[model samples]
Target: MGNSVLVFAEVKDGRVKKVALEMLSEGKKMAEKLGGDLSAVLMGSGIESLAEQLGQYGADKVYVADNEVLKDYTCDAYAKVMADLIKANEPAIVLYGATILGKDLSPRVAARVETGLASDCTDIGLDDDGKFTATRPMFAGKAYVDLSFTDSKPNMASVRPNALPVSPPDESKKAEVVKVDVNISPDDIRTTVKEVMKTAGEKPDLTEAEVIVSGGRGMKGPENFKLIEDLADVLGATVGASRAAVDAGWRTVDDQVGQTGKVVSPNLYIACGISGAIQHLAGMSTSKYIVAVNKDSEAPIFQKADYGIVDDLLKVVPVLTEEIKKLKAEG
Candidate 1:
């Protein structure tokens, strides 16, 4: 097997996703450590122009599988193309961003290639002998485990979004693009995407947001979520909700953050009136900086927060929002 590292650069709405760039940056480091080149694969229609952006991030080579059938993501077509590429190239390492698409696609491709996959990895590295090792949270973030692939030709791992830092692009860099001809027909895909319904508002996806402001039972009711939203707006952060808030019907399930919901690692996490439960902490404990606001000083969230405010959220959030707005105005 070749020692090169291949990254699956996922695209959305004609633009390369940020996590894909993060993988490219990380993959570049891994490739160098392994004494090989870093390459990327892009699978989408009318996405040939995006290869240059991949090169700017650090891809030495880019494989483009552009076809109309591949316009929208389908389990059958994407998995077939990715698996075929792995078989043909036989890279030593394969990296994927643990986004919704990555979570769905990586396992399918690994299964087809008959390889072991480490899912939702927070960190990955190579041993002295260049063996791939991945670190993943277990048992609701209470523990972490390190895993290594055994005799797998292409050691596969899906890394969580925002787990790694993205490197700045070098515009001078360019990649050697190779076009792959997709042979799949409409009949090959069993499921069809009849329509895609998008949620309202331009809020960043919870998993990928750099900053998050979350609410819990202290939020009181659904109407009170406006405070969380206002704070998030001033900070340019996404709004998240603890399971308590969701269970209380104060927020939608999509906004829930806990063991039963989406796992997120952001640069900053603001917990307003959230008394940290183990299940709630499991999802966001990895955030770079945590600030907890709750009336109860004995709240469990204070134990994990880098900063804490012991006050009523209803009284504090509005002041916090106004203060942040003032700071922005002054700047």
Candidate 2:
């Protein structure tokens, strides 16, 4: 019986990503429920210093595999390190974020460990018999299915970003550090991250935002996206787009929301001018509250939206923004 719950702490620029903190928080809760210990594995070069932060987020133990090869993400390198960790630790469950790196690495690691994997899961928990059960969307978001593994030692899954909330970090507790050196060889890796480019903007990351305002083909053109941005800015929310909009070059891939893009389950998801596609719903149907503004009342998005405003979004959105501002001012 190795550690019961182990979360992979994803790092970028020597800092832990928010999604990793969310995983740690959820992992801690699950560990407590199962009467087990929570351990987090942080892998990256010069990331040992961030282990204490994991402790604040509810990790009982922090395992650091600091290596130069991990300075930049390579699917092969990450998978190898993760496989070795699982082999050595034999945790009852392993969790990864369903981001690009996780999508690339988890399947390989699962194969290496010879275990079944649930990808893009919305929720996970221990069933009545202490079995690991994962819940995921099925049939293109029309239904959800729960899966349980009977014989797997370390049940693994990659959760969609923003599906779970990050608990407040408790700074009082200090977790024990276990530093392990994985003797990685350059000859074992096939890919390399030679250069990295970043978008310079003040806007929030769609996947991690608390509120999101998204547009679709209904916006008609890229020039009209300013309305979407203005509304998002007023609410301090992130701007997103449906695949149709992104494919049309109205937005970048980073701002896309759907099965093929980033998954966002924010507190509020506002879809204006988006004629809902099944793939788009798969990413955001789990949102706490959904609001749709479109001219077509028959649009599929209305079915999932908690509040549906059937009207031309161009006319409705500006009024909606004015009302929101009025309410805020009154408050």
Whole-model lDDT values for every prediction? 0.93, 0.87
* Per-residue accuracy of model 1 over 1-331 as CA lDDT, tens digit each: 9999999999988999999999999899999999999999999999999999999999999999999999999999999999999999999999999999999999999999999999999999988987899999999889899999889779999998888989999999999999998999888899998998888878779998999999998888889989999999999999999998998888889999989998999999999988899999999998889999999999999999999999999999999999999999999
Those runs of model 2 whose alpha carbons end farther than 4 Å from true positions after fitting are 200-205, 259-261, 322-331
Model 2 steric clash pairs? none
Tell me how far the alpha carbon of residue 23 in candidate 2 is from the true structure, in angstroms, after superposition: 1.8
lDDT of 2 by residue, 130-153 (tens): 788899988767789999986877
Error of 1 at 295 (Å): 0.8
RMSD of each: 1.1, 2.3
Error of 2 at 261 (Å): 4.2
| Model 1 alpha-carbon miss at residue 202, Å | 1.0
Clashing pairs in 1: none
Quote the lDDT for 3 in model 1.
Answer: 94
Model 1 compared with the native: what TM-score?
0.98
Clashes of each: 0, 0
Q: Which candidate gets the maximum lDDT versus the true structure? A: 1
Of candidate 2, the 10-residue stretch with the lowest lDDT total is 199-208
